[model samples]
Target: MAVERNIKCVVAYDGTKYQGWQRLKNSDHTIQGKIEHVLSKMTNEKIEVMGSGRTDAGVHARWQVFNFHTRCQKSTKNMMDYMNQYLPEDIGVCQVEDVDLRFHSRFHAKKKTYIYRIWIGEYPPVFERKYVHVVTETLHLQKMKEAALLFIGEHDFQGFCSRKVKKSTVRKINHVQLKQEGHELTISVTGNGFLYNMVRIMVGTLIDIGKGTLTKETITEALDTKDRSKAGERAPAKGLILHDVSY
Candidate 1:
């Protein structure tokens, strides 16, 4: 029997040109699809890469992890080099290593961190327009900080999720840290797991608090009622990035 080598890689992508991470029959312009295409071409065989989770279209990723099994005997360094050479400029393999066959990127991940960047200055971010979401509205940073605390701890985040979901909505958030550097408001969330659009909705609700549109109590109401309409608007995907993932 031929041996199957399991390889894991850390990838960084702009996500501006691709449809998303997951491969779909409806569209072939996905991050996963693109990676598979390059790797398959080099290995002269079909390859399927599995990611930790699917990020929405236009969402950037700093360090996304994926795994795939191939019979090719190339060294890890060679594979990584070939990947960077063949993949598009927007997508790059930062690191690659061989792992046990049992290593599953999605199931083995312990925590994931996502950062949402909001540009608050009057002058729109010309260079970072595709990377950050520009909002000119005046924001009360102190009030937003207080509202962000509501997302900590475990809860049924039904209201925070916008996508139609069949799985349980219960997830635990370790912390939501907000920082301001110059005109950029960076919201970072570290969680055990997140439902679809959970972090974005939470950030949206915090923006509401900054604008004095929603009180801190609104978050409690949304969680208790389990109604999506009660939650704040979902932020744009362009502002969100998969900052990191830990196993």
Candidate 2:
């Protein structure tokens, strides 16, 4: 009988160039496609990896979790080293562990945290260009904080989600906070799950509030109305990052 095994891995990637996490027939620049390519080459067998969630194109990840089943008897270290050799420089496998066959990275995740970075100065530092969003206007941190507070708790975030989402828009937000370090502003949000473009939309709404484009009351009204147009625009994907996921 063939031995079955499962492996869980923590992955990080600079998603500046990739099309996203999922694989597409004609796209060769997806994170999943790159990882699966390296794994297939190393094991000489095709394998499908299950990611904790799908991140949109140009969205970076700091602690994305994924799992795959394998029949190889190699040690985790050996596999990790071999995979690194074949994987691109932008992607890194932080850790790997042997797991039971029943482990599913996506379904078992309890919470996910995402961070959106904005540079609130005239220009961003050259070194941080790929990771941060540059905003020329001065932001009102107090108003942004007030808007973020309204996002906490369960709500039907239909207004914040993009039209492409096929699933229900109801989601529970555990925490939402806005902080600033010099010219760098960070919006961190933790939740059970998020709808398509939800995080970006939230960030945009906060930004609109800070810029005096939208008021805090508008957030509650948008949520209550479930009107997509009432919310602010979706922020750029380059500013969003998957900070972590807890299982």
Candidate 3:
């Protein structure tokens, strides 16, 4: 019998039309499902691909990684060409490489960065509507920054995560910063790991602070209490993007 080997690949996808990165029953329009379908067709076998993490519905990824085991010894370039030819226009395999048999994309990741975009203007920009969350109300960037500072360091982020998450809520947030360029506000958060909806909820709470609806003290209280209701609304999925994952 021939020895099977593992192949690792980096991918990027525009998630405007797909239902995030995970595959679900009866869902043929998810990013993972679509990729697996094409890979299965190319390999002539049922190929199960594992992603580094799942991005929520309508969320986009600039660089995401995954791995799969294969029996055939095919060239990376050939596999890349075939994947692109069969994959939908929104998803693209950026690069392919042979990896160790024991390597797992999710477990090997060192950190992940997510960016939540906010458009604060009277009229939403036509070109960026698909990527940014439009908020007509003016925002105080300084206040948002102050609130963001409270999230730095390791903490049990139960309040910032959705209740649907089953994993441990303790995550180390390496940095949280808010930047503003014109009417665009970007919240970039780097963390060791995150729970479901963590970044989006954090962005929502900061937006609330910007709008004067929430205070810096409230953020501290939310973290201390570990209560979900004390935090701001969960921002829409369309505004959240997985910027990059580092290994």
Alpha carbon lDDT at 178, candidate 3: 84
Q: Which consecutive 10 residues in model 1 have the weakest lDDT in total?
A: 161-170
Query: What is the C-alpha lDDT profile of model 3 across 78-162, one tens digit per residue?
Result: 9999999989888999999998999898998889999999998887689989999999998888989988999999998998888
Candidate models: Cα lDDT each? 0.91, 0.91, 0.90
Q: How do the residues 166-237 of candidate 2 rate in per-residue lDDT, one tens digit apiece?
A: 677889999998889988999999999988899999999888899998999889988999888999988999
Better of 2 and 3 by TM-score: 2
Off-target runs (Cα >4 Å) in candidate 2 are 164-166
Clashes of each: 0, 0, 0
**Residue-level error in angstroms, candidate 3, position 194:** 0.8
Worst 10 residues of 2 by lDDT: 161-170
Model 3: weakest 10-residue lDDT segment is: 160-169
What's the TM-score of each model vs. the native?
Answer: 0.97, 0.97, 0.96
Off by over 4 Å in 3: 164-166
TM-score of 3: 0.96
